[model samples]
Target: LKGQIHGGVAQGLGQALMERVVYDRQSGQNLTGSFMDYSMPRADTMPDMEIFSNPVPTKRNPLGAKGAGEAGTVGALPAVVNAVLDALAPLGVKTFDMPATSERIWQAIEEARA
Candidate 1:
């Protein structure tokens, strides 16, 4: 269960911070067609996670076990994005897009200053 959640979180983090589809505008070719061109989450990029499980059995289920599938992935994207936005709130950055790359964050800061 813990491994599942961790894996999901890693996937979510990638989506939130690194995953992007790039294309060559002139040729309409997919630029990010390979792992070498595409950015993905690495071991060093992942934050230390502490997961606390509180199991609540459903009355409908005989074992009362709930599905944990995709739970981590579902929660991670918004949580990471919101956290970044919250950090930038004081800088007048009111909104930001997904895959909050370093370049994008810097752009947001510059825009806020402007």
Candidate 2:
């Protein structure tokens, strides 16, 4: 479950900030078609993750426990995206769309600079 949280946070960060599945408007070729052409999530690109457990068991399960497997992803994704936005807020870049590609981030940075 912990690993799931960490990995999902990392993936969601990439997906929300650095990864994309874009295709060319003219030829319909996916801009991220190849592995080499696609931006991927890497450990060195992220910050350390810390998970806190509330231990307040839920009513949805039989073991006095809620499902942790997918819950971490459900929760961490937002946190990661929000963190990115917060980190970039000083530059007047407050709003962002998903798959926050490098192109997009760079554009926002440029726009902020302008």
Pick out the ten consecutive residues of candidate 1 with the lowest summed lDDT: 61-70
Off by over 4 Å in 2: 43-50, 54-67, 112-114
lDDT of 1: 0.88
lDDT of 1 at 87: 98
What does the lDDT come to for candidate 2?
Answer: 0.72
The candidate maximizing TM-score is 1
Residue pairs with clashing backbones, model 1? 57-64
Which segments of candidate 1 are over 4 A away from where they belong?
43-45, 55-67
Question: What are the per-residue Cα lDDT tens digits for candidate 1 across 1-114?
Answer: 676788789989999999999899899999999999999987787788899897777899788766677678998898999999999999999877778999899999999999
